[model samples]
Target chain A: MLRRIFALMLKEFLALLKDKRSRFVLIIPPLVQLMVFGYAATFDLKHVTYAVFNEDKGSISRDMIAAFHGSPSFQEMPQIERNEQIAVMLDRKTVQMIIHVGPRFTADMLSGRPAPIQIMVDGRNSNTALLIVNYAQDIVNRFNNDWVAGNGGAPPAHIVTRAWFNPNLESRWFFLPGIVGLLTLLVTILVTALSVAREREQGTFDQLLVTPLHPAEILIGKALPGFLIGIGEASLIVMVTVFWFKVPLLGSLLTLYTGVLLFLLSAVGIGLMISSLAVTQQQGMLGAFFFMVPAIILSGFATPIRNMPALVQDLTLLNPMRYFLVVLRGVFLEGTPFHLLIPQFWPLAVIGVVTLAIAGWLFRHRLY
Target chain B: MNNAQMRLLGLIRKEFLQIVRDPSSIAIAFLMPVVLLLLFGYGVSLDSEHVPLGLVVEQPDADTASFTASFGNSRYFSSVPFRNTPEAVDAMMAGRINAVIVLRQDFARRLRQTDGAPIQLVVNGVDANTARIVEGYVTGAWGKWLEHTALQQGQTLNTPVEIVNRVWYNEELESRNFLVPGLIAVIMTLIGALLTAMVMAREWERGTMEALMVTPLAMREVILGKLIPYFILGMGGLALSVAMALWLFHVPLRGSVWLLFATSALFLLTALGMGLLISTVARSQFIAGQLAIITTFLPAFLLSGFIFDINSMPPFVQAITHVIAARYYVAILQTIFLVGNEWSVILPNALALVLLATLFLGLTRLKARKRLE
Candidate 1:
């Protein structure tokens, strides 16, 4: 029985890798995605194009404009001559923000009253707008510190921040492991989701049914390729994440591997369940995506689950990707211990077993 | 009817009948976009709110109480009190809290003696974006508390420069305002590419292509036959998504409706042309679907500035965004909806769409002629 399943698994592997297109699909796209998305997925804002509408011609205002010129987050657009240009530039999104330094003339500040600096920003992409605001605020705070220290008054109260897991707060460290789970799931689901459906479409399911493989054996045979492929794909991504991206692998290899194993089991189970229900490869493809998009969104991979509506948050409880994400980030960033990750591990195990059982039942019931 | 037009009509009818029989195409076009839009509009948010923060104040005093109350009153965090730093650290490691704030024993004494007191902030940096926001919120809260304390004591704080913010376009900065519009590009890509590409590839796989080639119909008729019905179907999908964005989600549409429709049609052609190009390359439905996903769909999601900022992206990746059709479409859609009919943004992106549509359709035509010969 084991030998028969092994032979079936070998055939499946060959079928996926033997084709030039399939081989290209397996290796090239994941790497391209990993690299492109790794760089593109950062929340840190830069090259924030803004036209400086400086109203003040004072020395202090000169220093402030100079400070704006130096910030790495900001890039100065060609100076706008009239106020109408601000509207036109912002409306066309040629510039994301416009810094309107009020015409304080340095009179308020040198005389001990606070001068107001108005920041006008295009809020189309609100998160980016917010980050830009924060950065601009930093520049103002630094300027205030210098002006006060030079003039002999004390600086205001400030908090000293020390980030625990990532000292520099590089977003790549946060998003890379999440992408490993995401792309690994994508490849795994596509591989298994199409396996049985391909056989059905090509009139090979009947041929397989008569080959003395029991229903359980057929299910295992169908699942092994996805499971093995998922593991191989995940390991390669994990390596690329650590070595290529330089994201630290803070936890034990034993803990990470345990997570990879359980995560792949659940992924394969979900894939097989989709395969069991699909009649054609197209249906399989569609079904995989139908499950995938919501899974990725709800998994707290890109956005935090806590931010989701309570009903939607409850809905995320059923998603295996959610559990795997915690394990991935925890192990990669937090160096979370084995026992600490057990809560995440058991849910994936539960989801894997339940899904596999459902797939088995669907296969038997769908069969004659 | 003329000979060529008659042949194309017959082929289009057949495609329509096939789509009617298969509900999956309709599902992909209309249903999937609704689900995705609902999720993006309602479920996902970048505005940090109600973050669980661990607060540990040793030897609590009036200063600590007021500071703690300041954090409690702020809308950003829901504070979880920990008895000590170790307890807070344990909670952070367990993922129960996102960050920890510790006020030492001499919290009040230091503030009176010195101008700036040190407040220790330990943030779980696993999610850097959230951590950054959390830090900002904490700083804002601390600053607010200090000003209040200084005012009550009849002392003016030395705040040299005050910041006054004015946010334009999306004044509230709801992520939904832009995401819903950008989503139209993604939804249109799936409907345009998946519908035509897989259907064209299926004909080849099922031996219908050989039957069709044996007919007196020209290859031009065949390509047009494939393009027309799916084009209409994809347009219908876009109209439905636009309606949802405008009315259901209450996302304000600021541009001319006619302009929106015209540019969307151009973008749809670009997407459908991509479908034809993929069918030419991979003649199997399986490969066609995979290729469409890898080339068209994923680029639409990541590289299109749908969620990620293009300016923030590295130079090499930003250069690649030029080739992605959805990038231009997203620009056009966001500009039209959020900003207005700014032809400066629209015309260039529309021209890019035209060029890409022409390039893809020309490539498909060349490849199809070769394969047919």
Candidate 2:
């Protein structure tokens, strides 16, 4: 029985690699998606487009405008002559914001009076808009600080900000660890999910049933390949993330790998369940996506799980990916010790056992 | 009717019958949009609320109590007072709290002095997006609290420059408004690609393509027959999505319904053409499905300006988005949904969608012929 299952595993590998497209599917998409997600899946804005309606032509106002000009974050658009242009340009999305330096100019500030500067912003994507406001506010605060110093009236208070995990707060540090779990889940689920459905559709399952092997042996043979591939894919992505992306892997590799191993087991189990449920490969594919989409969304991969509604937040408890994301980010960034990571580890193990048990029952019954 | 028309009609009937038999296509078309829309609309939010913030105050003073009270009253933070900084930092490391604020023993003492007081804030920046938001909210809350405290003390704070920030379009600043509209493009891309590509590739993999090629019917007629039913199914999804966006999610439709449908029809044709091209290249459903996912679905999800900001990406990646059909479609969808008939935004993207549809369909035609060779 052991030799037969081993032979079946070899046959699975041979079948997957024999097709050039499947080979490409197994290798290229993950790498390409890794690169894409690493670069494109960021919320940080490097360049902000804004038009200046600086009615105040004072030396101080120019000095303030000069501050914005010097910063790499701000890219000054073509000058808007009238207030009307702000609307038109904003409507066309030619500029993300319009910095309207009021006509009062530097007159109010030098005389120890409060002056107002209006920043007309496009709030289409509220996060980007808010970030733009924050960046602008930083520049203005510097200007105000200088004014306070020169006037010999020191500012009331200052914030001493320290970021613990990611010093520069680079978004690359945040998303790379996430892609490791997400892509691993995608590949493992697709591989295991497609195999049984494909064999069933091709009427090869009956031939296997007629053999001396039990359904349990066939299941192990089928699941081992997906588990192996998932581990290999995850390790490759992590290596690339650390070496190529220069994202520091602060925690021990042993800790991270332990999570990866347990996570793959759960992913493989879920995939087998989908495989048992699907009648055709297409149905299998759909089932995989059905699990993956919600799994990913609720995982706090891109969006925070805390921000989700109370019920949805509770729903994420059932997802294995959520715990894995925490493990990945915690290990990569926080250098979280193994003991601290236990809360994330056990859920994946539990999910793995539960799903595999159901898959076994489904396979034995050949139930859809 | 002519023989060619009769053949095309017969093929169309077969495609429709196959769709009826296969429930997955229906699920892909209708059920998928509902699931995707609801998930994106409700589950995914960029807004940061209820961020767990830890406060570590060394000595409790009247001023410190008021400051902590202000923080407690703020909607942005759910503050927990830790015994000390070490506990707060430990909680931050454990992922229980994202930020820690420490007030030294002299927090109230130095506030009235010339050099003012200093408070320490340490944030867990592993999730940079949330960190940036948390930092911004913390700053805003601090500023408001200072102003309120100053007013109560009957001391007018020496105000320098006041910023009047005016936000136009999406005044409520809900990420859902934009995220929902952009998601429609992704849903349509999946429907058009998976339904058309997988079905056609199945015909080839099953050796029915060789059989169909031996017939007197032209390949163009067969292609047309394949395209129409899926096109109708895709449009059905489009209609259902827009209706849900309006009634269910309450997303405002600022543009004309006819114009929205018309442009969507153009974008759907582009997506369908890409699907046909993939199927023609990959004669097996397995390869076709994977290829469709690699070329169309993932790129549409990421590079299409759906969720991620296009301008924030590297210059090269931003340029790569120009070729993605969903990029144009997302721009069109967001414009039609939020900005109304902003022709300058709509026209160029629509024109690109038109060109892309022609390119993909023309390539599909070139790659495909009646011959099995």
Candidate 3:
């Protein structure tokens, strides 16, 4: 039975690897996506187009606008003459922020009075808009401190901000670990979901069932190829991320691979269950996609899980991607020890065992 | 009825029959919308709240206690006290805390001598966006603390400059206000492109395409037959999603629903055409499905300004997003839902949608010729 399952697994590999498109599907997409999404998934605001409406025309206002120009974050657009131009710039999205200096700007500042400078941010993308406002705030705060220090007054509160793990806070470092989990789920689920359904559609399942192989053997045969491909795909993405993308991998390789294999088992098991329930390849594919979309969304890949409603957060415990994301991020970013990651592993293990047992039961039931 | 019209009606009827027989497509068309709507509307949020923090105060004093109390009292942070920086760092590494606030031993003396008391904030920047948000929240908390302390001291240190920050369109700054509207484009893209791509490919995989090709039906009839059902399904999805956004999620529908429907129809045309084009290009089910996902779904999710800011992206990538149909749809959705019928915003995005719809449908019509290659 073992030998027969091995032979069946070999045949599955041959069919998958023999097709050039499948080979490309397994390799090229992950690498291409890694490069494309790596650069695209940035939260770091760089070279934000900004326009200045400095009505003051004082040396101080010019000096303030010069501060924005000196900073790398803002690219000063052509100065807007009227308030309406600021509105037009925002409406056309030509500028993300407009620094509007009122007519009394420098007069009040030199006379020790409160100068109200309006920073009109196009809040279409509120997150970015908020960050741009923060950047502008930092510049203004520096100018205020300079004014105070020159006048021999004490600074308000000194905030010494340091970001641990990712000092520069590069978003690529965060997303790379996540891609390992996401791409693994995508590949493993697609491979396994397409496996049994493909055989049944091609009229090969019956011939294989007529062999001396047990239902358990067929299940193993169907699952091993996807599990192996998932790991292989995961490793390639990991190498690209660690080497090509230069994301630091602080955890031991053994721990990362162990976590990946366990995650793959659960992903493959879910795929097998999807395949067993599907009557055709199309059904299998759609079912896999149906499961995948929600899984990724709820996994906290792009959004924080704690931000979710409590009931939905509870529901995420059942998702393997959710566990794997924590493990991958922990291992890659935090160098979380093997023992520390045991909590994440157990849920995946439980999910794997339950899904595989169910899949096996369904295969036996179908055969009978 | 005319003979041609009768044949087209029969074709559409057959398509619907096929849809009913295959539970997967209908299940996906209907079930996906509800599942995704709930997940996106309720489960997914960019709002950073309830962030865990490790508060390490070395040689704590009354002033330090009062300062740390502000962090504990704030709704944004839940603080866990630690003895020193090492212990807090350990907690941060273990993922027990998102950030660490350290008040040095001389913090009280520095505050007493001058207003220049230094506090160190160490944030675990694994999630860059989360880290940035935490930093902002912590700063706001510190500023509030400073203000309270000044009030107690009877000293109002007036600043030379004050900023009146007004976030336009979204007053309360709810991330959902934008996210839910943007999600409409993603849903329409998935249902229109990814779902329709598979149906045509499944026909080829099942050898039904050959049978249909041998019939007297025109290619236009066959294409329309495939396009019409999914178009209706996509519309149904849009209506259900918009309703969920407005009623369930309580996201305000500020624009005209009829205008939204009209623009959605145009976007759906482009999405459906992209689907038909993929299915025709890749005859096999597996390749077609993969193609649809890589081409439509990923682009819609990533490049379409669904979540990430497109203007923040590199210029080359920004250029790439211009061709993605969902980009235009997302722009239209955001304007209609948030900005409410601003023609300056709506007109350009609408014109782009029209152009993209024409381009995709024209390409699909060309590729979907009757002759089998």
Deviating ranges (above 4 Å) for candidate 1: B370-373
Q: Model 3: per-residue lDDT, tens digit, A89-207?
A: 88677788888899999898888777999988876666667777777887887776677777887655678999978999888788778877877887787688877777777778779
State the number of backbone clashes in model 1. 0
C-alpha RMSD by candidate, in order = 1.8, 1.8, 2.3
Query: Local error of candidate 1 at B105, Å?
Result: 0.3
Q: Alpha carbon lDDT of residue B268, candidate 1? A: 94
lDDT by residue for model 1 (B1-373), tens: 8888788889999988988887788887878888888877788776667899999999898878988888764566899999999989988988889999999887778777656678999999989988888887887787678678778789877578888888888888887887788778887887788777777778788888888998887887888888988888888888888988998889888889999999999999999999898987788777776776667656788789887889999999999899899999998898888878889999999999999999999988877762542
DockQ of each: 0.71, 0.68, 0.61
| Alpha-carbon lDDT, every model | 0.84, 0.84, 0.82
Ranking by TM-score: 1, 2, 3
Scored against the native two-chain complex, candidate 2 gets a DockQ of 0.68
The runs of at least 3 residues in candidate 3 whose Cα sits more than 4 Å from the true structure, single-residue gaps closed, are: A366-368, B69-72, B111-117, B146-155
**Residue B181 in candidate 3 has what lDDT?**
82
